[model samples]
Target: MKQNIYHQFITKKSSGKKSFAVLIDPDKVNAKSIAELVKLSIEAKVDYFFVGGSLVISHHLDECIQQIKAACSIPIILFPGSPSQVSKYADALLYLSLISGRNPELLIGQHVISAPFVKKSGLEIMPTGYMVIDGGAPTTVSYISNASPIPADKSEIAMCTAMAGEMLGMKLIYMDAGSGARRPITEHMIEKVAQHIDVPLIIGGGIVDPEKAYLNCKAGADIIVVGNAIEKDFSLISEISAAIHSVANVNAG
Candidate 1:
């Protein structure tokens, strides 16, 4: 079994360290691509691998986990879109609640149905408050979750929402712009949410470049997650990883 993954997050947050995670949608990558990604992730010294998508219509979830496990020891965290996405092969599962949306199903309905299986799977369950922010375009996450994102410019709303999630005992708070977003979440919004929450803040979606990753880290994101961009250009793993780790290095100096 993998070491406690949530504790790792807490430790990194407390120590002022930043992490980079590669998000792999099971339906998007095959064995060959997974092998390539795992190789790049190992070389880049990536901190984590977030495995899942908004709509995973494939049966490759377990296979994907196994492939990554076969090549490297980097922790695999299941960022599942639904109850059916769980796998015992992962080191942890981000049991997400869509706090930005009013949809009852995503907020709690799915959790109830997946509880027993998740409990039995032995995967470290990290309850997370997941918020979707407007990224200048409609996204699959917003459409599938049936929830409207908090407007991109609403920093106050994002701050309050993160505070509520922390108050409710969420282990982490994740604000995403959704896959293939036209714009990334603003640094101001990230700073606002980070200032308001005590738990680790995870920022994802539309981060396509090393500069954006670096800026997000400087804005107080504890973990920067990149998916579609990395899928399009696997070489980004090294560049973004370097950018995120550089923040910690600078802080240490």
Candidate 2:
């Protein structure tokens, strides 16, 4: 029902808090997951469900979104990796730019092509600056995206990129280590970036358990997103959500 998701979310139009959003890539999720995932996500109080992948080989995206939206009340946001991944069923989109890459296509050319369609669909666009960090293994996103990730140890490089993204008007900075990551972005990197940027920071990839997700939150990541872990074991969803949500509780007086 909301027309402007960024204004609403970043401006505290909903509440004065930024929330944790869960990423659900349809390509990685199995046939049996749609119904149960929606139920589990709701039960975990996840703030959103992100649907989309770099390559959607099937035209089942809309159906997937429909099924999940029908099963849950959480906002369905599209984390599209390509033009074909866009859909109207999702409430919003993280119109992402691979800022860490030098590829013009992913950096802006794709956005130019997809802009009109996204505008026509009336889905809220949440402009994002996406940075890929080396996760200790060659992951699907890294291999398919065809871009070199910023070295995991280079917090300075990450910081400058995030600052540049903010200056360029991106509302969110998502630092990912790539799916099937052998490692996740470091807490020190998270703290460095969080300290330098004003936008909501989103961290994902290699977060296969609650403690890892919570540690990222402890380092000031506003939202911790995990997808592959859930696809591998749905029962881990409740555990992860509890661990992540408890970060706030531990700090409360």
Candidate 3:
């Protein structure tokens, strides 16, 4: 099997270069908007483009991915909410299992249903342990998954959850605060989880500014994902990317 671009990207994280990704929810943003976002992301030197949402009530996923691919050369990775969100147009899929929640479906039921189609699609399958941490708001992912978000201050629980995911052979561990969060995951929480886990750490949700992004990276996040903030202010793409890149440069130096 050919190594996917995302897999290769993760492999390089050990070199201490932090990465930045822009997340696009296909349901909320139209194809034209996605094209524009991709253009901006490319100009900002973003490392990846994440496509998906918690509840995809719309049917424009393929359209969204196609538009992004048409406008940019960056890797398009699927951050799917459910089985229905799969599309062949993406370069990779974050085959996520909600390890933090007790929901059976999110842990395995959804994967069982989506596996065949995913396998056929030939997209790089990056099995990820997806954990939702309390972000000071009720987000769609927690509602849709029918699972409770881990308490914001539970670093030990988060660490153990991530460790379990790694032991289960997950390629990545994603700690999310869900969209529209009032607070991003704390640097202490990220530090605790990253210290216990061996895989790349992806931190997302409610990161409203470059300073927050910088803190997450400094706390040991391998890839910092920004979405809602970018939606509100596209200029944040450049600022956040620069912040992450600045950290990477300093780390390398």
State which candidate has the highest TM-score.
1
Clashing pairs in 2: none
TM-scores, in order shown? 0.98, 0.93, 0.97
User: Which ranges in model 1 have alpha carbons more than 4 Å from their true place?
Assistant: 1-3
Best by lDDT: 1
Q: Kindly report which residue pairs in candidate 1 clash with one another.
A: none
lDDT of 3 at 177: 98
Question: Between candidates 1 and 2, which one is better according to lDDT?
Answer: 1
On residues 111-178, what C-alpha lDDT tens digit does candidate 3 reach at each position?
A: 88878888999888888999999999999898888899999999999999999999999989999999
**For model 2, how does the per-residue alpha-carbon lDDT over 1-253 read when each residue is reduced to its tens digit?**
3446566556641232435667777766655678788788888888778787767777789988988877877888898879778888888889899999898898899899988898888888888999999999997667777899999999999999999999999989999998778989999999899899988888998999888888888887877888878888988888888877777677662
> What is the per-residue lDDT of model 1 for residues 1-253, given as tens digits with 9 covering 90 to 100?
3349888999999999999999999999999999999999999999999999888998878998998999999999999889999999999999999999999999999999989999999999999999999999999989998899999999999999999999999989999999999999999999998988889999998999999999999999999999999989999999999999999889999
Q: How close is candidate 2 to the true structure, as a TM-score?
A: 0.93
How well does candidate 1 score on lDDT at residue 207?
A: 98
Q: What shift in Å separates residue 181 of candidate 2 from its native position after superposition?
A: 0.1
Ranking by lDDT: 1, 3, 2
**lDDT (0-100) at residue 67 of candidate 1?**
89
| Every model: Cα RMSD to truth | 1.3, 2.2, 1.1
Order the candidates by TM-score, highest first — what do you get? 1, 3, 2
